[model samples]
Target: MKVVHVDYRINEKINVNQFYDLLVNSTLGERRPVDDVECLAGMLLNSNLTVSAWVEGKLVGLARSMTDFNYACYLSDLAVNRIYQNRGIGKQLQILTQAQLNKRCKLILISAPTANGYYDKIGFTNNPRCWVLERDSDISI
Candidate 1:
């Protein structure tokens, strides 16, 4: 058997290029504002918790989240390079992300349509109560 190592980290500052490259190589690129450098910068700058996976100093996987460390944690983005998927990197990213939070802080995320089964198999239950509000959309109550 071949032994492989994946380094999992917390709060490490990763540059936009590294992050952009990873997203471009992953399935997430399609859904992100990759062409918007400012948006990418803001996303990283605003995230309070970031767990990353590195292989030989190269950014391979990342989990960017926003959390209060007390009540709730919203995992905004979890992406693994397309070539590196299904090797347990994504799961490790989530594991490390949740590890940073208090036990009472429920880790939550809106799964990509393609990733729904993946989250379910990794101990996340389905919750239809989640809602979204796009920037241009109006709130009518």
Candidate 2:
């Protein structure tokens, strides 16, 4: 078997189709807005940090995040093509993301139900108090 030589690029702007394709090929796609190109474009354009993994010019993993650099970082998406899932690319992507932050910033993410164990294995402490307000939910002033 030929060993795949993976290269990691930090904060490089990626083509939307490549990003969309990797998302769809990874397990995270099940929870992403894969059918909406505009939404996906906005996601890439607005994110403050992105780390991507490529093998022979093909995108195989990505970490997309939003952060203030000093307080908190919301790791909005972490995906690795199913074929590349077990080689530590995901952990390295997270590490690269953290490296761009201020020393005090805390990396945070809402684990996809299927990925909680994986996060635990990679040193993420479970925070049980996270709450969410869906975009469609009514709000009171």
lDDT per residue for candidate 2 within 47-125, as digits (tens), equals 9899999998999999999999899999999999999888999999999999999989999999988899999999999
Q: In model 1, which regions exceed 4 Å deviation? A: 1-3, 139-141
Looking at candidate 2, the ten consecutive residues that score lowest on lDDT are 1-10
| Inter-residue clash pairs, candidate 1 | none
lDDT scores in order: 0.92, 0.93
Clashes of each: 0, 0
On lDDT, the candidate that comes out on top is 2
lDDT of 1 by residue, 15-84 (tens): 9999999999999999999999999999999999999999889999999999999999999999999878
- Candidate 2: residue 22 lDDT (0-100): 97
Candidate 2 yields a Cα-based lDDT of 0.93
